[model samples]
Structure formats: C-alpha cells, structure tokens
Target: MHNIKDLRKNLDYYKKKLLNRNYNLNIDEFVNLDKDNRNLISKKEKLEQEKKILSKSKNKANFEKSKKISEEISRLNKDQALNKKKLDFILHTLPNLALDDVPIGKDEKSNKLIKKFGKIRDFNFTPKSHVEISSNEIDFETSTKLSGSRFVVLKNKLALLERALINFMLDVHTIQYKYTEVSPPLIVNEDVMFGTGQLPKFEEDQFEIKFNNSDQRKFLIPTSEVVLTNLVRDSFTKKDDLPLRFVASTPCFRREAGSYGKDTKGMIRQHQFYKVELVSVVEPKNCLIELDRMLDCAKKILDILEIPYQIVLLSTGDMGFSAEKTYDIEVWIPSENKYREISSCSSCGTFQARRMGAKYKINNNNEFLGTLNGSGLAVGRLIVALLENNQNEDGSVTIPDALKKYMNNLDKI
Candidate 1:
C-alpha cells in the first residue's frame, strides 16, 4: 500500500513516476476527491460545532436548528465515506515505483542480462528435453487424472531428486547463509495474502477457499515468500531486530489465470510445485545491501549445482507489482535452447512493509521496514534443468556433488 500522505503531498511527482511504468493514472481525479472529502469533513465539523452551541442554549429554535444540522451531518458523512472509498481504491491499485536504476521498458525484452555464468554443457549425443528424458518418472497422465493441466507426478528417483533439491537448497540457505528455517502455514487468511500483495488486485490468480463456519476466506500460498515474509506482519521491532532472514520449503499453488497456452507441455509451468524460498526483513536504509546479499544466496544454489545460468536485471514494466526492483536468475535449459527463470530476488523497499504494518523502532521513530524475498531455488524447474543438463546417454541423471549427501550419497539417479 502507498502512503496517502506522500501522494497528497506531491501528487505530480508520483504521477510522473507511475507514467514511466505504463500506467496513465489521473492524479487530478484523486486530488479532486481528496479535496471533496476534506470539504465534507469541514462541513461536518462546522455543523457539529453549531450543534454544541445550540444544545447549550436549549431554546426551541436552537433545538430545531440542531435537528436539521444533524441530518446534514449524516448526509455529508455518507458522502465522505464514498469519496474515501474511491480514493483508497485508486491508491491500492497503483503499483510500486521502480527504483531509478531500473531499466525503463515495456516488458521482458528490455530486461538487461547483467551476468552469465558456467559453460553450456556439450553432449556428444543429442540432448533431450526433461519431458522426454524423465518420461518414465514424470507422469503427466496420472497428474491429469488426479488434478488437471499444469500438474505432474514425479515417481521413483525423480521424486527423491525433487525432495533432495528442496533439502539441499534449504541447507545452503540456513547452514551457510544463516537464514532461520521456518515451517509456515500453507493456508493463510485474506489479510496475510494482502500483506504479500496477492490480494485485492491479483485475486484471480489465487486459490481461495471458504469454510462453512466462518466469513473469512482462506487461500493457498502461491509461494513460501508470502508466508515467510509475513511473519513480521503487525510487528513492532527494535533496532536489534533490524535484519531478520528466514528460509522455507513449501508447496506453491497458482491459477496462472492469464497464461493459458504457455509452457503447457511440462513442469516449466505448474499449478503445484515445491520451492525453497528466502525472505529478509531489514531497516529501510539497509534494503539494497540486503538485496545484493540475498541475490548472492540465491545464486549460490545454481553455483553449487553447477548449472549454467544468467542474472537478468528486470525492467520496470516487467517487474512484479510489489517489487521496487528485481533480479531474475534464469538457468540454462537445453530443451528450450534458452535460459528459463528459476528464481527472482526482489527488494520491496517498504512497499510490503506498509501493507503488512511491519515497522522498526529507531529511537522515537517508527519507520516502515524493508522486505525482500527470492526463490533460493524453485524445485520443479530446478529438476527440469538438472535432468536436461546432466542427462546421460543411458537416460539417467547425475546428481550434483553438493546434493549427493542429501540423496543418500547416490551420485547417479
């Protein structure tokens, strides 16, 4: 959520920034509504003052006048409520302003590839896609029978590989990187979802459920980031708690609402998948520092796995709704003959803090805290990259050295 005071203080400044994001919002409409709301409040207060004076007089005419003023006040309050609703609607829908360093563009094509790592593996035999390589292990037909499209069942070693990947990533993030491991609830209330910018605007992409006994609706988390990052919701932290980092491995669900026919063949796009997510909360001033540190932690997974990948700095228009800036780590997929996104590290620069009511106390000041989240590694896509890149001519996968212990020291699966 945006600070209404900031918008009201300098509407034009925000309007220009948002225009760069391809949103043509009319600040004039909001300004007018704000003016009208203030006018209504002023009118109501004036009438209330009159009522106070009239009640003290206690005369027949004053009493009659007070009754009429009460009616006007009631009508103005209703109007004020309507105007405030409209104002809030506009404010809530506005996306976060991109940082000045972000590349200005309309979409992903404009994203900058900051660095590329590892050499593309050379295979004497023709490389096969993960779908073709793991045909015996990943059962799409069974997944279809159990659920629907964009789902898959990994059996035998493939399932173990997926679990192994999750544990390995969590180990790297927790043991080496010092992120506290957390097992957060998968089902969250509406407020928790909203705190992570998954509600109000992106409800269509959420899987919502209703309980017969309660009015509150619950939704399955689209990522562990939603749950891990929200641990500090409605919290007042001391400066000693300035930097809090957490890691979790959880199942994520997404409706993929508008992405109808894309990546429909394999695990590239799935409704259900496992991910090892990392979240960091820090003082506002340390946000960027934490972002770089967090990015390194995510990149370390690809590094340890020895997967060839590139880090792309996302363009403003291509960034997520809540991210002020984002860096996508795209691992090389030989099947697609391109790099595919395996993780996105983003610094939300107090955007999510305002939404979640997370604040840090510095002396007497309570300032909006900074929050960052990234996929230490997305298990499904990681599996895809692992299978495709490490496939042997005999159709078995060679587990990375870093993950061998987690997979019972079985180097080949």
Candidate 2:
C-alpha cells in the first residue's frame, strides 16, 4: 500500500514508475476522487464546528439547528467513507514500484542473469526426466484418481527423501543462518492474506475455504511465506531485533489459475507441493542488504545439494506484486537440458509492511518495516533436480553427501 499523501503529491512520478510495470494508472479518476473526498471532509468539519457553537445555547431553535447539522455531518461521513473505500481499492491493486537499479522491462525475457554456480554434470548416456526415472516410486496415477491433476504420491524411498529434504533445509536455516524456526497455520484469515499482498488481487490463484457457520474468509496458504512474513502484521518490533528471520516447511496449495498446459508432465508445477520458505523483517534502509543475505542463504541449500544453478535478476514486470526487486535461482535440470527456477528471493522493501501495518520504532516514531521472502528451495523441484542429476544408468539414484546422514547413511535410493 502506498501513502495516499505521497501519491497525491507525486502523481506524475508514480505514473511513470507504474507504467514500466505495465500497469496503467487512472490518474484522472484518482485525482477527482481524492479531491471529492477531501471536500467532503472539509464540509463535515465545518458542520461539526457549527454544532459545537449551537450546543453553547439551550434555545429550542439552536437545538433544532444542531440536530440538523448532526444529520448533515453523518451523511458527509458516509460519503467520505465510501469515497475513501474506492480510493483505497485502487491503491490496493497497484503493484509496488521497482527499485531504481532494477532492470526496466515488460517481462522475464528481459531479466538479467547475475551469477552461475557449479558445473553441469556430463552423462555418458541420455538422461531421463524425473517422471521417467521415478516411474515406480512416484505414483501420479493414484494421486490423479484421488485428487485429480497437479498432485503426486511419492512412495518408498522417494517419500523418505521428500521428508529429508524439508528437514535438511530447516536445519540449515535455523542452525547455521540463525533464522527462528516456526510452524505456522496452513489456513489464514482474509486480513492475514491481504497483509501479505495475496488477497483482493491474486484471489483467483488462492484456494479459499468456506464455512456454513462463519462469514470469515479463509484460505489454504500458497506458501509459508504468507504466514511467516505476516507474523509481524499489525505490530511493532524493537530496534534491537532489527532483523527477524523465520523459516518454515509447509504444504503449499495453489490454484495455478492461469498456468494450464504448463509443466503438466512432471512435478515442475503443482497444485500441492512442499516448500521450505524463508522470511526476513528488517529496517527499510537495510532491505537490499538483507535481500543479498537471504539470496545467499537459499543458494547455500542448492550448493550443499551440489546442484548446478544460476541466479537471475527479474525484470520489473516479472517481479512479484509486493516486491520492488527480485532474484530467482534456477537449477539445472539434466533431462530438460535447461535450468528451471527452484527458488525466488525477493526484497519487498516496505511495501508489504505498509499493507500489514508492521512497524518498528525509531526515535519514538513508528516506521514501516522492511520484509523479504524466498523459497529456501521448493522441495518437489529440488527432488526432480536431485534425481535427474544423480541418476545412474541402472536406475538407482545416488544421494548427495549432505543428505546421507538424513537418509540414515543410505547413499543410494
């Protein structure tokens, strides 16, 4: 959410910034509505003043006049509220402005590759996709029968591997990186979702829940990032705790609304999947710095898994709704003969904080906090990369050294 005062004063500046994001702001509509709302506020204040003056007299005429003024004030209050609601609706739909140094473009095609790590392994024979390699263990047929498409059932060692991956990520983040581990609720209220920029706009992509006895809006979290970042919602943190880092491994559910016919053959895209999410809350000035640290934390997981990956700075148009700048880590998929996104680390600046009402005190003044979130790594996609990259000609998969302990010293699956 943007400060209305700032938007009112710097309309032209915001117009250009939003345009780069491919969002066309209705400047004229906003200006007219703002003016009307302010006018109503002024009128209401004058009527209240008149009522106060009238209250000084006990005369019948004055009483009647005061009652009339009170009614007028009530009417103006409603009008102002309705006007503000319309204005806020517009503000809520606008995407965060991109950081100055972010590349300006309309989509991912213009994204910039920042770094490449590890060597892509050379296989003597043709490598098979995860679906083909784990045909016996990963049962999509059973999952489809139970829950339709975009779901999977990993049996035998593959099931153990998924659990191991989640545990491995949580340990690395909490023990080595100093993030506080949290097990947050999978279902959240509407306001909680809105606080994280997942409501009102991206409603279609969410799996909303309904109840026969309650009116409260609820949803299955698309990622633990929604719950982890919102831990600071409607609250203030002490300066001593400048950066609050949190990690969670959870089952994420998404509608995949506009993603039909994409990555349908494998676990690349799914309605249900596990993810180790990382969220950090810090001072606004240190947001970018925290982002760099967060990116490294996520990259560390892939490094430990010995996966070859590259980092890309997303274009302004490709960044998430709440992020000012974003970095995506794409891991090499041997079967696809390409790199696919396994993690996306983003610096939301104070955009989410403003929406969440999350703040920190600085010299007696409360200021919006900076928030960042990233996939420490998507468990399912990581599994795909691990299996495809480590597959043997005989069909067994070699486990990476880092996960060997977690797998009870079993080096192969």
**lDDT of model number 1:** 0.91
Q: 192-256 in candidate 2: lDDT tens per residue?
A: 99998998899999999884568898899999999999999999999998799999999999999
What 10-residue stretch in candidate 1 is worst by lDDT?
208-217
Candidate 2: which pairs clash?
A: none
lDDT of 1 by residue, 53-139 (tens): 999997977888899988998999999999999987887788899999999999999899999999999889889999899898999
Best by lDDT: 2
Clashes in model 1: which pairs?
A: none
The lDDT of model 2 is 0.94
